[model samples]
Target: MSKRRIYWTLQIIGWSVLIMFEYVPYVLEYGFDWDNFYNALINIVLGIILTHTYRLVIRKWNWSSLPLPSLGFRVVVSALVLGLIMALINQPLDRHTLEQNLLDQPLVFWGYVLSWWKSLLAWMLSYTVYHYLEQTRLADYEKIMLTMSMREAEAKVLRSQLNPHFTFNALNSIRALVYEDPAKAQIGITQLSNILRNSLLADRRKTVDLQEELRTVEDYLELEKVRYEDRLQYKILADPHTVYWQVPPMMLQTLVENGIKHGVAKEMGGGFVELSSEIVDDVLLIIIRNSGRLTSTESTSSESGGVGLKNTAERLSVLYGKGASFRIFQEDEKTVRSEVRVPTMSENPVISAKEIRSF
Candidate 1:
C-alpha cells in the first residue's frame, strides 16, 4: 500500500486499540456504561487528531534532518506537552460526565500524564527513526550512481583521445606511400577506411568481441605495411577459445600501432611486432612483443607511445578498476613486451583448450 494509506490505517488502529485497552476493562467492571464508552470514544478521536497534527508540524519543520540530540529533546518536549493536553481534557470530561474527581488526586492525574507520555514518545521515536533510515539509504544510493556516471564519462573522454591520435598516425603512414607507390597507397586508403568504419561503430559500444577487434588490427597492420614494406614483419596469434571474449574497442589496434611506431620505425633493421592472446584461469591475457627497449622513464611518460600507452592504461582502470592490468617492460636486450590481463565477460563462450591460431 502507499505510504499515505499505511499511515492513516496505522494511526486509526493504534489510537483505537490503546483507548479500547482502558475502556474494555472498565466496561467489564461496570456492565457496559454508554457514558464511559462515549468518553473513551472522545479520547480516541482527540488522540488521533493531536498526533496527526504533530506529524504535520514535524514534516513542515523537517525535524528528521535534525541532529540526534536536538531531535531527542524536541521529541521528549512534544510528548510531555501532548501528555499534559490529554490529561487536562480527559480529567475535565471525566469529572463532568462520570462525577469522578481525578484532579483532586495529584497521583491519579500524573499517572494519566505519564501513561500518555510513554505512548506518545514511542510513536514519535518510531516515526523519526524510520524516516532517518530511509533518508540514509537514499543518500548512499545516489552517491554510488554519481560515482558510476563520472567513471563512464571519463572512459568516453579517454576513448575520444585515442581516436584522433590513431587517425593521425594512420594518415601519416598512408601519406608516405602516396608518392612512392600510388597503387599501394590506394589500397592503404581502403584499409584505413575499413579501420575507421569499424572504429566509428565501436565508439557506440564500450567493448567488442576479440575476433572483430582483431580484424580492425589486421587492417591497420596492412596499412602500416604499405609504408614500411619488407622492413616491417609482424605476427598475430590467438587461442581459439578466447576469440569470442570481449575487449575494449580499438584497444588491440592501439597497442599494435604503438609497437610499430616505437619499435620497428626507430630500428635500423626493421623490427617485428608480435601480438598474442590466451585464456588463463578465466582471464584474457594479451601480450605484444616488439623489437624495442623501454627505459624506466619511457614506460610511464607521455613520450613512451605518444598517449597510446597512457590512454590504454586509463581506459582499463576506468572499466575494470583493479580487475584489469596493463604494463610495458623490456623482455630482452632488443624486445619490449606490452602485457594486458582482463577478466572475461560473462557473455563469453565457455572456453575449452584449443590450438592457438597464427596469422
Candidate 2:
C-alpha cells in the first residue's frame, strides 16, 4: 500500500482500539447508551486530530534530522502536551456522563494525563525509529550508486587516454611507409582504419571477446610491420579454449604495442615479440614476451612506468579490483616478459592440453 494509505489506516485503527478500551469498561460499569457511544466517538476523533497535527509539526520542522538528545526532548514535550489536551477534554465529559469529579482531585487529573502521556510517547518513539532506519538504508544505497558512477567515469577517462596514444604511434608508423612504399602505406592505412573502427565500437562496451581483441592487435602489428619490415618479427600463440573469453577493449593491443615500442624498436637487431594465452586454474592468463631489457626504473615501478603500462594497470584495478593482475619483468638478458591474469566469466570444460597457434 502507499505510505499515505498506510498512515491513515494505522491512525484510524489505533485510535478506535484505544477508544474501545475506555468505552468497554464504562459500558460494563453502567450500561450501553447512545450518550456513552457518542462520547467514545468524540474521543476517537480528537485523538486522531491531535496526533495527526503532531505529525505535521514534526515533518514541518524536519525532526528526523535533529540530534538524538534534541529529538528525544521534543518527543517527550510534545507527548506531554497532547496528553494534557486529551485529559482536559475528558475531564468535563467524565463529570457529566459518568458523574466522576476528576477535576476536583488534582492527583486523579494528573494521573490521567500521565497515563495518556506514556501511550503517546510509545507511539512517537515507534514512528521515529522506523523512519530513522529507512533513512539509513536509503543513504547506504545512494553511497553505493555514487561509487559505481565514479568508477565508470574513471574507466572512460582511462580508455580515452589509450586511444590517442595508440593512434599517434600507429600514424607515425604509417607515415614512415608513405614515401618509401606508397603501396604498403595504403595497406597500412586500411589496417589502421579497421583497428580504429573496432576501437570505437569497443569504447561503447565494457568488455569484448578475446578473439576480437586479438584481431585488432593483429591489424596493429601488420601496420607496424609496414614500417619496421625485417626489424619486427612477432608470433601470436593463443589457446583455442580461451578465444571466446571476454577481456577489456584494446587491453591486449596496448600491451603488444608497449612490447614493440620499448623492446624491438630500440634494438640494433630486429627483436621478436611473442603473444600467448591459456586457461590456468580457471583464470585467463596472457603472456607477452619481447626481445628487450628492462631498465631499473621499468622493473621497479610497474605502476609508474610508461603511460600505456600504467593505464593498463589502473584499468585492470578499476574493473577487477584484486581479481585481475598485470606484471612486466626481465625474463632473460635479451627478453622482457609481461604477464596478465584475469578471472574468467564462466566455468568451462577443462582442456587437458593447450592448443597453440603461430602467426
Candidate 3:
C-alpha cells in the first residue's frame, strides 16, 4: 500500500475500535461501567501502538508502486495483528473489571470483541476508497510535470536550430560581398570572423552580457553596410546602466536582421534602422525599428517574414515562460518596430576578458 493508504487504514481501525468498545458495552449494560472507562484508555494506548506499527511498515516496504493485491494483503494482515494485540490487552482488563464487582462474564467477551472488529472493518474499507481517489490526484500531478518538461526540451532544440540557420544566412551575405567588392569583402570577412568566434563561444552559454550581444549586432550591421553601402543606415542607443544586463545570445541580433531584411532592404529610396535599449521598471526592453511600407508577400521566408519572430517567441517562452515579452507592429506608416522585454539581470562588471574582447 502507499504510505497515505496505510496511514489512513490504521487511523480508521484505531478510531473504529475506540468508538465500538466504549459505546456498545455501555448500551448493553444500560448504565455507565468501569469496562467503558477501561476500554477508552485501552483504545488510546492501542492507537499509539498501531501508529508506530504503521510507520515501521511504511519504512520497510518502500511502497511507491505497490499493487492492489499487495495493498489488500497488507490491510488484512495489519487488522489481524492489531486485533490480536487488542485481544491480549482486553483479556486481563476484562477480568480485573469483573473482579472489582463489575457484572461482566468472560463467556460473552469474544462476541463483544467480534462486534468491534466488524466496525473496524467498515471504517478501513471507507478509508481505502478515499485514499484511492487521493492517489489518482497525485498521479495526475506527476504526469503534468513530465509533459511540461518535454515541451521545454522541444523548445530548446528549436532555439538551437534557429541560431545556426541565422548564422549560415549571415555568413552567406559576407560570401556574396567577397566577389562583388574585394576591398569591402576583406573587411566583411574580418567582421564575419570576429562575429563567428563570439557566436561559437556564446553558443555554450544560456545568456551573454547585453554589451557583448550588441557588439556582435554592430559587427553584423557593419558587414551589411559594406554590401548595401548608402542604401542602409543604422544607429544604436542604450541606457548606460543597463548595458551589462544578460540576455540570450543573438536574440536582439535576429530582431535587427529581421528589421533590415523585411523593412530597410526592400526600400528603394534607402532607409534608417535603429536599435535601442532601456530599463523600464525591473525589465530590460530592447527595441529595433526600421522605415518600410507595411506589406506581406507569400515569397517572404518565415525566418525573416515570420519564422524568426516565431523562433524568438519560442526562445523567450523557454527562457522565461510568460515573464518575458516580444511584439512586432507598425508604429506608423513609414516605420515598423519589434520590441522585446526580459527580466533585467543585476550588472556583473567582471564577466570575462574573452567576453569583453567580443566588444
Candidate 4:
C-alpha cells in the first residue's frame, strides 16, 4: 500500500478500536459479556485487515461492480472474519465470564452476531470517506493544470496576432518615404526588411533577449528618421544587467513604434523619442517617452488613428496579464510616456542569454 493509504487506514482503525473498547465495558455491565474486552480488540484488528482487502478489491475490480453483489460479498467476508477472530480470542478470555453468560440463555450468541455487523459498518464508513477525499484531491489538481493550459494558449494567440500587425506598421513608414527620396527609401527598405525577417524568426519563440528587441527598435527608428529627417532623433539607454533579461519576443519594438507613431510623429515639427531600461525593485522597468501628449481622448480609442499603441497594449495584456503592468500617460505638455514593468527572470541562464542577444 502507498504511505498515504497505510497511514490513513491505521489512523481510522486506531480511533475506531479505542471507541469500541470504551463502550464494551459498559455493555459488559448489562450482562452482555461475550468476552467483551477480548472481542473488541480482535474486531478492531480484523476490521482493519478487511478494509485493506476491500481497498485492493475496489482498485482491481473497478467501482462499477454490481452494488447488491458487492455488498453481499462484503457482508459475508466481514462476518466470517469477525467470527474467526472472536473464536480465537475466546480461549484467552476468562472462561468464567463466558460460562456465566451462556448458563443463563442463548441470547449471548445473538449479541455476538450483532456486534460483528456493527464492526463491519464502522470499517465501511471510514473507508468510504477516505476514498471520497482522495478522489476530490485528484480532481482539484487536474482543474489547476487545465487552467494553466488555457492561459498559455491564449498568450500564444495574442503574440501571433500582434507580431504581423507590428511589421505592417513599420513597412508603412518606409512606404511614406519612397515618393520623396528614393535613395533614403532604398535604405529604409533594407532596414525594414532586416527587421521583418528577424521578427518572423522570433515569432517562433515565446520570448527573446532584451538586447535583440533593442536592436530591432534601433532599425525601426532609422527607417523613421529617413521620413522625418533631422526632425526625428532618438536615444537608447539600457542597463547592462537588464539588457540580458528576457521579454516577450518583439514586445519592445511594438512599444517603441507606438512612441514614435503616436507621440513623436504627432508633433508637426517632429520630436525626439527616448528609450530606457533599468532594474527597479527586482523588476525590469522599461520606459518609452516621446514629445507628444497622451490626452484622455487618445486613451479611449486605440484604433482612433493609433493602432500601434492599441496593439502593444493587447499583446502586453495577453502575455503577462496581472503579473506585469503597462501604463501610458502624459508626462508633460510636450511629452507622452509608456512605462512597462515585468518580473525579472534573473536565475534562468537561457532566458538571460536570449535577452542580451543582439540582431
TM-score winner between candidates 3 and 4:
4
- What Cα-based lDDT does every candidate model obtain? 0.81, 0.82, 0.69, 0.68
Against the true structure, candidate 4 has what lDDT? 0.68
- Rank order by TM-score, top first? 1, 2, 4, 3
Model 4 has how many clashing residue pairs? 3
Better of 2 and 3 by TM-score: 2
Clashing pairs in 4: 209-354, 209-355, 210-355
Runs with alpha carbons beyond 4 Å of true place in candidate 4: 1-129, 175-190, 304-321, 345-359
Which candidate should be chosen as best, given TM-score against the real structure? 1
Q: Candidate 3 residues 1-359, lDDT tens each?
A: 56657666766666766666667777687876786767766676675566456545643673323787887776666665566556556655565664543245554655555554565455444555455555565566556556565755755565565566557767777877766788977887787887777767654666788899899899888877766879999999988977888888777877787777778888898798899999888899999888875566312344354457777777777666677888888899999888899885422122222311100
Tell me the tens digit of each residue's lDDT in model 1 across 53-115: 888887789787789899889999999999989878876554453245453566877788999
Candidate 1, overall lDDT? 0.81
* Residue-wise C-alpha lDDT for candidate 2, range 172-199, written one tens digit per residue: 8899887888898888889899888877
Q: Please identify model 3 stretches exceeding 4 Å from their true place.
A: 1-81, 89-148, 176-186, 201-203, 297-306, 345-359
Error of 1 at 248 (Å): 1.7
Q: Regarding TM-score, does 1 or 3 come out ahead?
A: 1
